[model samples]
Target: MGLTAEKRSADWLAQGGLRPTRQRLALAGLLVGDGEDRHVTAEGLFAAASDAGEKVSLATVYNTLRAFCEAGLMSEVVVDGSKSYFDTRMDDHPHFFWEDSATLTDAPKDELKITGLPMAPDGTEIAKVDVVIRLRRK
Candidate 1:
């Protein structure tokens, strides 16, 4: 896409309260218009930026992702506690992660339903729930 397209996307994001800096805009453009979903870690996003000719440091990517999450432009997925993966989809849904390839894909909502949990601890209720169904080639 051209700079105009980039600027337009930035404008849409800015309307959502995100200050789309150049790096942020570049990252935004990458995360969208690809015809597929994305699940990128900080390192993954950094490499992608470089490949896309977007000059950005790893730290900058990390910070920008945090800002994007805060601005509601992206969703942070933490399937593992050690590292977090950024997801662009904001809708409520589940995921299917391929363990062999470490690829994350969306799981159709109708395919599953989780309910009837025992209960939360005293004085605590469900804050947020994430379900990632892992898969491997059999």
Candidate 2:
């Protein structure tokens, strides 16, 4: 069963037309091998790799994450411009950002809305809009 789940995730990446290399497969296993989604950064992923006893370079983690995002296996959320968090959920949903804890959570899709459309910049188009709602401790 464990091997089957891992293979399913690897195959999912393969179905996206991405080469499931060892590093990519290893990262994918950490990201979605379990039945739950998670928010992680490349640095966090590197830590996870260490915890799992997997040897992966930071550059490789970033590269594989970019590839996964491009292949639709993950979503990139830029809570802070300098740093970005990755989400394993591949659906159109907003995010709940806990500033104090530095965590990202899925917001109910129905609680979001968009109005007053703005014109697109020259030679650019809107692909997807990610809304991040921040929360604080009382």
Candidate 3:
């Protein structure tokens, strides 16, 4: 990786109050080095790390992803209960889950509209709303 990209990776981790470990730097580089938003699963990230000769274990990848989520570096979007996707874009936006190819992409925020939501119970208040529209090719 180029020096600029490496620095960016390190800086990102640092900004999130996470130590820039060797493995984290590598994974961060893969996730955000290109300056593009994407969604990835633990298995997929492990495979990519292996393909890139990262020498990281699948368990490590899972742990790293969880850490990233906890640190607010990424958001975990759970689909179908069993499967989850980690997204690099940190914003209040909806997503489109392509059922045919099992891919997740951002949905246009302007097009999605919600009229009413049930009031929170007791002293609680609404935290956030997640919208995932599933799509399939006809």
Candidate 4:
């Protein structure tokens, strides 16, 4: 038989080296239950939890998202100084941020390329680079 959503979420969390607490299970189930990749912010996820009858606070959502990112289960995309999005798809890719709608969408990875990047600092190593193409109505 197939595993239930809760069970699957619990297993995933365990594999990610995270303890499967009640709040974690609930939030993880909501985030990854459908097996579809998604990008969401803390406020957006909190609204979703509220709509789904899950009693999760915004602060809890933020903390949980940070934990998930630290566990390598999700990726954080910062669009602006004040706005950040959590992406479920961890593979290397780019994103399109719609300014008017404040939405994020995946860009075609094969079509994007980076060149002419400056050298890293004397003692620092270059980490992964993220590209976010911003869009607005014409």
Best candidate per lDDT, number?
Answer: 3
Question: Candidate 2, residue 23: CA error in Å?
Answer: 1.3
Clashing pairs in 1: none
Clashing pairs in 4: none
- Write down the TM-score for model 1: 0.86
Summarize candidate 2's per-residue lDDT along 1-138 as a digit string, tens digits.
Answer: 355657867777886789878888788888877757989989999999989999999999998899888988888999778779999888889999998988888888997788756888999998778799999999
Model 4, 21-72: lDDT tens digits are 8889888988787777899999999998899898889999999999999999
If both were scored by TM-score, which would come out higher, candidate 2 or candidate 4? 4
Model 2: lDDT of residue 98: 93
| 19-123 per-residue lDDT for model 3 (tens digits) | 998899999999998888889999999999899999899999999999999999999999998899999999989999999889999999999889999989999
Name the lDDT value of residue 26 in candidate 4: 85
Better by lDDT, candidate 3 or 2: 3
Query: Please, what is the TM-score per model?
Result: 0.86, 0.88, 0.95, 0.93
lDDT values for all models: 0.80, 0.86, 0.92, 0.90
Better of 2 and 3 by TM-score: 3
Q: Candidate 3 — which pairs collide?
A: none
The parts of candidate 4 lying over 4 Å away from their true place are: 1-3
lDDT-better candidate, 3 vs 4: 3
After superposition, which runs of candidate 3 have C-alpha atoms over 4 Å from their true positions? 1-3
